[model samples]
Target chain A: MTDSLQRKRVVITGLSVVSPLGNNIADLIQQVFGGVSGIKLLDAPFVDQLDCKIAAQAQFNPADHFSKHTYSMLDRASQMALYTSIEAIKNAGLILDDAVKPRMGIYLGTGMGGANSLEEGYVRLYRDGASRLKPFTVLMSMNNAAASAIALEHQITGPNQTFSTACSSSAVAIGEAARLIRHGYADVMLAGGTEALLTYGSIKAWEALRTLAEEDVDDLGASCKPFSANRTGLVLGEGAAMLLLESFEHAEARGATIYAEIVGYGTANDSNHITQPSVNGQASTMQAALADAGLSPNDIQYINAHGTGTQLNDITETNAVKKVFNGHAYKLSMSSTKSMHGHLMGAAGALETIITTLAVNTNMLPPTINLIRPDTECDLDYVPNVSKTLPNLEYAMSNSFAFGGTGATLILKKVK
Target chain B: MTDHSVSSDKVLDIDEISKVLAQMIASKMELDIDTIKADSNLKELGLDSLDTFDLIFNAEDYFKIKVPNDQININTLQDVTALVHRLIVAQKQ
Candidate 1:
């Protein structure tokens, strides 16, 4: 409320995660630290049909565990999405006590929105007829369905949108939401991503793209081998993650538990290719985010990488990290959460943000699971296969690179 | 059971309808002239789910028929032709 042009300060007050490794935040932190792997073999109909059967599907179905809403309008993906959003709002100390609900906003991201639901609808249509399709099919299948569902569920009348930039979707969503709160668009915001494309059609689409691990279909214990020489393809995953953001003053006034402050966010596109990643864009995006936070590269102690375990991504990201961090790259602790949780695509950024946030909150860094051998080019300290406790650090950065050469980076600092 | 074709005064012709349906999709999607076949699968012809929906939405506008969601999954170009033809005849009746 002080300046009309300058954005206000933003801080994270609430957090929730539903990943392949775990359902709740506590379980996720434990499994991630314990070197537990979530990637597994698939027996579903589509897996059997695909050349690749490996995926990091959620260990437990949210519907089986969480309460089912009466609307039933949401596809399963949006269901987990809204569930995490509500949980974050409640946990964030913003409990809609009349005054808080009116000032809040929600934003979500997804690489593929309701793909499973649309696929199912198509199957029914092909087998049956026009009358067989569900009444809510179109509404549930929109790319913004997750955000829309959360808005309806929480009754959020504030700004609502969905980010869909392939993999960097959630990172951009989180950054934009932070910007909104900081710019006084709202006092608080709920931001993150949800993606559940674990279906035959989606897997087939991946297979067609030739970005899937064809041979490892039966290996239930396999994890994404980021920066590994043998890394050939990325693993698909499903889940949702949400964070509750509020202005620092607003949070302090409300006596909320502040986890960390979102200091900077940067986004850039390579304009090079539709699917391939560019090292220059990655470097510039990281630099831009650090600059936005008004911190030097030396300020970042940990980096949660956009390590998809694909050969191209690993090598490309390694070059970018080395260039950006210089010699200090080797000194910085960096790891890929995809190693254990698999690639949640759009949700990866949101989930990785939470992972970095938790690291700051708990003062412990999770391990890079299944890295038996380091890739020759990627020599950065990956904190291989074992978690380590660390001293409190002021700044950490998370990187997200999506298809279409879109890149996003977020830098966060402890709130003191 | 009934020789409706002979007595069909308000019915749409299936063959003519198929030709027009093919042209509509091929024109809108900018089909690879050589690839577009009357019997070829619509998906194989590069008509993705979104494109298919777009075709249906346009058809709904032109025919003034509320196309149901379940019937939108027409697999082949022939399937689309048959659907349009049947729906037209039904609407006329």
Candidate 2:
């Protein structure tokens, strides 16, 4: 490629997450290392009415973190996004002034934007027989509410966008944010995904889908066992994770702590089935990401699998990995942090990408916590049950496969 | 049409209503209750459009009265107190 056509190097300058594991990156990383599963029996009134009684709920109180006016204006998802964004920006040490405000962008993802607000509105309108709804209901319940709120809070005037592609939403957000930076559209981007669909309506909707894990498990932590032979289904989760991505030159000029370099992003659609995952699509996307980074499959030492704990998804993802990595599949370490944190849906990829980046930076692989019995088909080394340390890890990939057959992969290399 | 019930003839207490309204506004604005004054302009309270909306909704819930959408233009705390008294009287009638 010509010098002018060369893509700019994008590096992760900061990371933050409001996960069930914890509210900040340090606590979340500690939980991941300790194999602490955040899944628990939900305490909502609708829990008795649903098939699944468990979820990985974020430990956040909007009243504690935001002003009443701010919390009223924000849905749960937006609140989490704003909290994570503030932490990430502060951690990145990027002061937003008049000069940089216009160039800073926000790319966020949410599977069900403001579902809590929508549910509350509906309850008030129907159940309570209230003729008038809250005036901010429409604003809070909109899919772009989180993104817009983040932009308004941070004064980011650049391309502000939100992606709602089911579980792959945040991964796509990160990928698109990197593209914006690589193409010289922006220097700093706040990118990630957040979801707060723990409301009655949200849980009931998932119950109707019948993909939630059965509620009879003795241990709630082991309910979501991705790639396990006895795995039942996915446990719903909610949280927000944000990453501050900046051009290499921008980060270095500011002397920011660079976590890892995001070298490649690849996304593809199965186009075959909406709910069913396709190995072909997954494999192709990983291959495409490897190609984008100009690295072979053997160069990657670890993969943060989408691993939704559903039988079909786990098996299909394993087959895809084997096809793409060939002989290197056995040597590579792969884990699904979702097994510990449940599945954050839209925010899954962002949180997992943070874990993947940390793995590359620290050379310590997070374990797939609940994998007591592995599926015969999924024979790859999953770094099961306990965290592992690798020496001189070079590159890692984070994968996100969604319900609509959308697949996204990002490649991050250890900073030299 | 009017009913000559004792409750209908009773005038709603303005001071109590003002206190309730100020508390709601203070809570919404995330300010101390003592800092909010009844004479302060609702706009000067640093409440944006959304915050104003929430304030009205909360007021309706507190008084068990329906606040009209057009009444959102209430400027001062006195104006809001008057509106609430009017709404409560109208609701009772």
Candidate 3:
């Protein structure tokens, strides 16, 4: 497709996050750039005997933040998403009229849906009986609950979907939402992911992988180190982000503040491992996104690396970036926002995109905190523990490659 | 994955089990540390029976040891902890 004809001009009009770092996107950016680490020692209940006992808890409870009745109806993951979606839609100054409300879509991504509910139902059967099941069990447990909750809360009448692809879930949702808007499938799309898997099952699953950082061995803030020599593993975090994506024309028609232009998005399967990453497939996805944006590696300045900090992930990611940029890897200022918020898993893509969007808008890159010792194979300008302002850069890219070999990248450009 | 692959792994450790159990219980009750006592009757806590199911599910995951249906009768917090301890120890064998 020709660059001109292929261009659908998707732009971020508003962004909001209910994240471990903070409750809103602007606050989250500040929290990250200010070097305020969200990782903390997991309290006793959450710290039973795991090797790693640190987490970036969202610090916001739906029951306290929203109506109790409303909270009861939605799963924790969906509740986290709804908080951000409401804020984002409002931040866009979108008091949607009937004309526009019907055209707004919601695409949400999640790692686990209503896990709490599923567990609760099982408990009921174990403790009580078959009759103890909640009437809304299936509705709450369905993966699309996040999207459905957003649509219902905001009265959005357009396409509603939930994408589930593990960690890449949200990134895929964001890209798909952009496609939907650009293709006139929807005018405004609330896109992102929400996750709160700090529960026993979720943490245990991660524990099985032996990936959770065990610095509760002590209060080590740098346990989330993404590409460093001492990098152990990711510190699990919880939360959600919602980005208001609309057609450039449509956004301008509504006089929305354009945060950043979604220039390109590319996704590819490694056809490799479910957990481990492949350098070739990762590089291919990055290359494809740059190509999709009609941008050469030279045109991009900052990258929000999908640096999970796990040994294999960081090494392979570092290799992918080097291969994709070749010699220009040194010129790029890459960072993992996960350093501040911990790994949000399904929500990581949406949260990282917000950081990348802000970078293009402010010309300042958020730093990768706790990156002290650089590993030999993983070498790059991972902006360490501080934000760097680069005035000349016009484009930023964010990458998210998840388990099951799903990898995705999105390129954003500064708006004139 | 029928979970046979789970127990066969050595990543399972003593310290890991406690951390997993703590996180599971807290997530179920949707409460902070103060409310989720190790010995507190899970029923007496603010979390109802629905919350207990989540606790059990998460416990199974954290330990990577299947909590059989017969063992799901966790009336007290001690029961939860003791059962988990037994299952986790058994996984080592």
Native-referenced TM-scores of chain A, all candidate models: 0.95, 0.98, 0.95
> Which 10 consecutive positions of candidate 1 chain A have the poorest summed lDDT?
A63-72
- Rank ordering of all candidates by lDDT, starting from the highest: 2, 3, 1
Model 1: per-residue lDDT, tens digit, A1-416?
44646878899999988788787888888888888888888658655677777788775565464443223457778877877887798788676755766778888889988887798789878866653455567888999988887877778888888889989999999999998888888888999998988898787888888876444444555646787766777888999999999999999998999999999999999887888888998998898898888888888999989988888888888899999999889888988888888889879999999999988878888877768777888888888889887786778889999888889999988877
Model 1 chain B poorest 10 in a row by lDDT: B1-10
CA error at residue A6 for candidate 2, angstroms: 2.6
DockQ of each: 0.02, 0.67, 0.04
For the second chain of model 2, what is the TM-score against the true structure's chain B? 0.80
TM-score of chain B of each: 0.74, 0.80, 0.68
**Cα lDDT of model 2 by residue, A1-416, tens digit:** 21437789999999999998999888988999789999999978777877788999998999898877778789999999999999999999998998788888999988999999999999999999988888888999999999999888888899999998999999999999998999888889999999999988888888888788875457887888888898888999999999999999889998999999999899999886879989899998898889888999999999999998888999999999999999999999999899889899999999999999889988999999888887999999999999999988989999999988888999999998
lDDT of 1 at B59: 60
What local distance difference test score does each model get? Answer: 0.81, 0.89, 0.82
True contacts kept of each: 0.00, 1.00, 0.00
lDDT over C-alpha atoms for residue A78 of model 3: 82
Determine which window of 10 residues in candidate 3 chain A has minimal summed lDDT.
A1-10
- Candidate 2: misplaced stretches above 4 Å? A1-4, B1-9, B67-71, B90-93
Scored by Cα lDDT, where does model 3 land? 0.82
